[model samples]
Every structure is written in C-alpha cells, then in structure tokens.
Target chain A: MATRQYSFYPGCSSQKGASSSNYLTSVQAMCEELDIQLNDIPDWNCCAASIGYAGGGELPRLTLSARNIALSEEHNPGQEIVATCAACWLSTREAAERLHEDQSLLAEANQALAEAGLKLKNETPIKHMVEALIEDIGYDALGAKVKKPLEGIKIAGYVGCQTNRPFGIDGESYENPRYLDKLVETMGADSVPDYEKKVQCCGGALAFSEPEKSQEMVKGIIEAAYDHGADMIVTPCPVCQMNVEVYQDQINQTYGTKFKMPVVYYSTLMAVAYGRSAKDAALNGQVIPAKKLEAIAAK
Target chain B: MGDLNQAMIEKYRTNFLKEVEANVEEGEWVKMCMQCGVCSGSCPLGKFWDHPPQELFMMIRAGKRDEVLSSDSMWMCTSCYNCVVRCPRELPITHIMHGLAHYAKRLGLVPESQPTAAFAQMFWDNLMQKGRVNELKLGLKLYFMNGFGDGIKVALKHQKIGMGMLKTGRMSPMEAFGGHAVKDLKGFQSMIKKAQELEDQRIAEHGA
Candidate 1:
C-alpha cells in the first residue's frame, strides 16, 4: 500500500464552498491514522466543470481540464491524479478521454498548452476518490477499519450526473443502480429505495443558467427523497451535496416543503460509522443538522 | 364450432395486460401495480379520461388501438416520468406511452383534442434547422401555429428564461461553422434516418 500514492487535486469548490473541503482536513487526519500519504498537487486550478461546457464546445472545456491535468503531471509524473470534487472528476476524465480518442485534437490541445508552458500527454488515469477507495482498497478491508459501524440508520445515496455520465467508468449503471446504496450498507446502514427523481439532476448549471428552474429541480428532488423516507442523502460528489443542501432552505421556502436532507460525503459517513469522532472526520460543516444525525447515530 | 359466451367481450378478453410491450418487466413492473389506484387515482386528468393507465396497458395488448390512441391521457402526460418511477414494476411506462403517442401522430390517428403531435413536429423542425433544441423559439412557434391565446405573455416569460440562460453561458447562438462540422452533421442525419427506418419497420410489423 505504501508503494503507491497519487497526487490529489481538490479543484475550486474544495478550496472554497463545499463542506467536503473541510472534510479534506479530516480525511488528512484519517489518512494519517491509516498511514496513507496523499500529496496535493501545487498551483492547481479549476476543472471548469460540466456547466461550462453545456453550451460551449469541447475546446474551452478540454483546455481548462487539461491545464489541471498538466499541473498534476508537472508535480508528479507517472502517477494517477485523484480528484475529490465531482465536477473536477468529470472534467479531468473528459480531458483524458478526449485526448485519448482524437490524436489531432490532442496535438492541437498540446500546441495550445505549449503557449502556456504546459504539456498534457493524456496518460494519467483520473479516479474519483471513492473509486480509488472502493476499487483499490476493497470494501471488506475498509469494513475492517470501521470502529463505530452506523448500525440501523436508514441512508440513501445520491450520485449526480457528473460522477456517472459520459460513460467511461465501468463498475455501475447511472439509472436504477444499487452500488452507492451498497456502499452505504458496507458502512452498516439500511439503504432505502427512493426511485422518485433519482436520475433528475440537482440543476447544477441551472443555478447559473436559470435560477428559478434550478430551484424547481432542487425542490422536486428533495420532495421525492423525503416522500421515499430517506433520512439523509449521501453523495460522492460535492456539487450535488452543495446544490442539494445550500438550496434546501430556498427550495423549502419556494415549494412549501420541509426538507432537512443532510448532504454528506460517503467517505465522511464511512469515517463516522467506523467510530471516528466528528472532529476526526469533520462532520460539522454538513448542511443537514448535525444533531439529527447524532440522534440517528445514537440509535 | 366453439360456443361463444355472450357475456364475455372477446376484444377485452383478448388483452393479456401482462403481455403488453409496456409490461416489459413482468416480474418487476407487472407485480408492482398494487391496483391501489394511486396511478389512476392520483392522475391529475384521470377524472376526465375514459381509459386509465391500467386500462391503457390492457388496451394496447388487446389490440384496441383506437381506444389507446384516441384517449387524452397521452397528451396530458407532460412526459414527467412520475408514473414510471411510482409504478411498482418500474415499467418505463412514460417511454412506452410516448412511443405510442408518436406512432399515433405518424399514422394521423391522433385526436384533435390533443396537439402533442404538433409539438413533436416543431421539435423536429428546430433540430433539423439548428442541429439542437431551442425551447424559446420552439415554444413561440408552437403557440403561434396552434393559435394559443396570450402568445406575447407566454413568449416573454420564456424569453426572460432564455435570456437568463444565454447570460450564464448555458444557452448560446450557434457557433460559426468549423472545419469538418458539416461531415459530422451528415453522419448524425444518416444515424437518425437509420433509427427512423428501424422504428417504422417495427411499427409496420406490429400493426400488421
């Protein structure tokens, strides 16, 4: 295990908005506890996200994502880059996939990069931190690390479009799937089935594109989740977590629905379930009320 | 020389309900229709319609094409897929329903009470011209063609949304034509034509 480690890219949101950024501090603490070293790439930039390219063509999006990939390469060659933010994960994956698929495009992108004093060969594999954990570390072994084991609490997992779309990662299907729920169960909880609006986007770009539309979509998702009896929504992506949580107050007000859906990282949840203290995992920044979670945990 | 029972409606009895293409996942979707009537019960337009969802599936399988296509239920769907998710079997009911709607439109079997077919044609028109969907333009075009009241107000509201979208870089005017772009468009058209041909062949066989 000590023989391999990748440079981690936190992306823009991790540096600013998301609770998962603070969660990173706890993750670092946990990594220390687990004796794993994850080096952060220096002078890293944004992945430009899925929203940036929703209207724009491949050039701008690919260029933006490739710059970060280039930075990772400069810091640590011949090693993979692990991304915490879902948008970053998608962008990086897109860059890598696009660069690999079209040689001419790759040459052009590199030529554009040369102007910026950067080079991207498209060789590195960008893995979502969860993928690295579940695929690389294996579930049963991680299960051995669980000290608290969140037993009997009901949790529903939400993996937004970015984490699963554009289709390269091959472990699960985006629709009607059970992997995230299974991941939650691995942490020792019942994964509730809420099929309503499961595939609907939380309107990530719509927050910028059409704020009202964004609000409507957010309200719809929360209502659907609540109707299905999800005590809390656990997501692997930070944007999904942020949109679902930050907009909850707005959504509740707009739609007249009581939505107390706590958005949490699957890793943080696992860390807590395994008996790590809240400080040990940093669950404080979570948008969902911490006390409610404590009550669920205590039971 | 089989004796026909006067009480049994042969047309109704011919419907397997279970065998309908809509009932694709018989074990899952078929088993889950609790008949609690939440589907028919909760439907917003259920009271005004003659064939409820349960009956629609039955009609499709029974070859009661007239009843299924002529109903207002398909028009009122909104393509929300709410019923699909709520259904115990997860039958992709909305997808199946939309296919039936499209088939009805192509055959001119659609009722005048619903104009969903007109909407479909407008969507194609936008796609063919622009290579993408422009909801604002499409909506206005639709409203005008159908003589919908309050076109200006409706158009203005959507235009505001469209303007907002444009500002956010979520919606934009078509980009300047790039090298090899026309080739890509031609390839896409060919793919679409192949898909339509396949669909038409299937409908022909099924209708036969």
Candidate 2:
C-alpha cells in the first residue's frame, strides 16, 4: 500500500522524557511498519489539557488548541492533524468543532491567533491515532503484517474515556467500542470481548489531584481486567495507561489486594507483533512489566 | 478579586441560575437538564462527591448560589465525559461541570484548600512560563503544595516510582533546569494574553 501522511501532535505527555514518551517511540516504529508518514507540526504548544479548564477558562483553552491547528494548517497544509494523546485529540477537535459552530468565537480566536502571526481557518480535521489505525489502515491489512502473532496471550482492550465518549470513532457504540478488541484479535491474541469495565473512566487528570477518589476508580478498572482472566490490558490513551498501570502498587497497599497488571498501548502491541525488538516497542516504559509481551518479543 | 465577587452578587441579585447562564461556559445548558439523573449515575466518582451532577443542577435552579459556588463537587470531575454522552437531556454535563469550576475560580469562591483548583493554578502558571509544561517542576510543586514537611513525606512515598521513571528514561532530571518550549514564546504568550483580555471584555459586556 502507498504511504499515507498525517500531521502529528504529540502533546505534553508524549514529549521527550515525559510520561508517555515511550508511546511516541512505539508509535513511530509502528507507523514505519505500516508505511505511514507522520510530520510534526512545527512548534506545537500544549493543548491546555482537561485539567486546565479551571484556570484556562474558555477562550484561552480554545486558543491553545487553535494555535496548534493553525500551525498544522500552515506547515502540513492538507494533511489531517492526528494526536496520539487522547486529551490532545479531544481538546483540539472540540476547539475545531466549537470554532466552526460559532462564527464570533472564530473571529475572537483569530484575533488572538493574530498575535502569534497566525490565522485559524478552522478547516482541518483532528483525529485520534486509533481512528487512523482502524479507518486508514484496516484490520485485514494490519493483521497481514503481523510477523509474530500473539497466540496464547489473553488481552483485555481498555477503551477508557475521552476516545470513547461524546464523539467516539465512526460507528462505534459508546457502551462498547470494539476497535481495540478487534485490533487485539488481528494480532492473534485472545480478545476479551465482554470486559465489563472496558469503557470505564480511569479518573483522567484527577489521578494526581484527588488520588484517593481517582485510585478508587482505577481499582475498579484493573480489578475488572483481572476478573476477566486477561494476561494484560491494552489502551489507546496515555492517561488511561499511566493511571491504570502506575497506581496498582499503591492500590494494592491501600486496599490490601495485590495487583500486577501491565497496561500497555495499542501501538506497543502492534510494534511487538510486527517483530520489533522490546526496546523498539518501548516495552521497558511499563512500570509493571508486560512480561507476557516481553516473552513474545523475545521469540 | 473579592470586589468582583461582591459586584457579581449585587448585579445578579437572587437569580443564581441566570447569573450562571451569563457567566459560565455552557452554563446555559444547566437549564436544559430534565433531572433524569443519568449524568450522576454515569459518573464513576459520583459516590464520593458531596453533590452529584443531578443534585448540583437542582441546587442551581433552586437559587442556592453560595452553596453551589463554594461546593467542591465540580472539582471531582475527571472529564471522563461519561456524563456528557449519557445525559438524556444532552446537557453537556462535563463541560458544565468544568465551567462551574472555572466560574467559581473566577469569583474566588472555590472551596479553601481545594487540591484540584490549586494544582490547576500551578499547572497554568508553569505552562505560561515556557508555553509547555515542565513536568518536573509541576510535579515538585504539587508535592510541596501543602508545606515543606508534607511535601517531603509525599515525595518519599513516591520515590520508588520516580526512580523507576528515571531508570526507564521516561523522565529526565535535566528537565528541571529548562524544559521544552515553543519557538515563538513571545507570540504564544501574547496570544494567550489577548484571549484572556477578550474573555474579560466579554464577561464585562454581559455584566453591563
């Protein structure tokens, strides 16, 4: 297949040395295998993430994402803007949608953009990486390139919030998004189609601000995965992956329940299944080692 | 800040719902809620909140301004958007929750020692400096937010995770000095300033 191109927005979490930097690494490797080109939008700023709302207000929050969209429109021209971070995709897409609906807001946003020597035409389409993987690169094509199928691994596809709600991928039910499970099946793993907490919330940014409440929510997510008899959990959002994986030790200590579930990205799974090395797949980034996938990669 | 708060109270009188409609982002949607309670039921953290989304909407309509504004319930929203999609009235419940939080912050009515509000301010301040977040500084600030003594305790508790992150190269100590930034820092700051000013102007006009 011909190489498809997209303007990539790697948000704050996926930056070098950031929480999800390994996500960026694995995505780069996976994209190369899939014959896709990701061009970085020059000097993209923060999406002002969901947590920023309290201080960022409305217009400032919208402008932050608008600035990135404007930069992509200017530099990458016709390519659609793709964000691997779920928050970035949601923020940027919300900005684009709101701007298009409100002409006055668009005018005001352009007024702010003008300070940065830019203008937002509000014409670009913002998408999450999973949308691109499922729509642009179909499951059949993705499955065809899997050099080493993960045969024995039992996987629970965690479609946590942001990507699953408000505006889910094309034709996906909010209650049950099957794209992640389908991707798992394509990689020849046992997909737990009925993972009860598949669309549950991992408490997003609140994991840092309200640890007790957020950890309670995270406990439910990880506990459900274990109940499903899954070897590991896979997710698309960096926040979901981080919250569910990193808090297990603390949760175990607090709740007196030992949990050691490895929460990894869909890109990491694809990279390993495509016969990439553990380093190439950035598997070392997992706080709880994905020992199962690591063993698969060792093969 | 208190002056704006006082002036807003006098301006809106007892009509709290109308005041919210004029001030909050997507505040007008609050009136659209039919009290189906799906948003409250759908929220994963609803049980922990003092006032769930449905109760908050009810309170708003009941003209419980001081109680609603000072409540910490809205800060519990993780932006999971479950409430948004499940709202039978399509109230944009998530945005309304955030809008209420922002409005309370603007009026300086956020509950005292609210962790979410405090962290949001720290994050905004950090981002404004370099156009991107210096995660190291922000994390350090969060740890020390309560006091030096408390900060030390929290830091020690999470030291293992920090070391693990550093060992895996997921975080860098060098970032504490100077983190990533947009190339046109001046322009970015000015654009943000312009947006804030415009928002203030819009709010002023609405008040007028």
Task: List clash counts for every candidate, in order.
Answer: 6, 0
lDDT of 2 by residue, A38-123 (tens): 99999999988888877798999999999999999999999999999999999999999989988888899999999999999878
List residue ranges in candidate 1 displaced over 4 A: A1-4, A16-20, A54-57, A295-299, B1-208
Q: In model 2, how well does chain A match by TM-score?
A: 0.98
Candidate 2 chain B, run of 10 with poorest lDDT: B199-208
Docking class of 2: high
lDDT of 2 by residue, B12-83 (tens): 888999999988988988888888888889888888789999999999999999999999999989898988
The DockQ figures for the candidates are 0.02, 0.83
Q: How far out, in Å, is residue B146 in model 1?
A: 33
* Deviation from native of the Cα of residue B123 in model 2, angstroms: 1.6
Q: All models: lDDT?
A: 0.57, 0.91
* Estimated TM-score for each candidate: 0.57, 0.98
Candidate 2 lDDT (Cα, 0 to 1): 0.91
Q: Estimate the TM-score for candidate 2.
A: 0.98
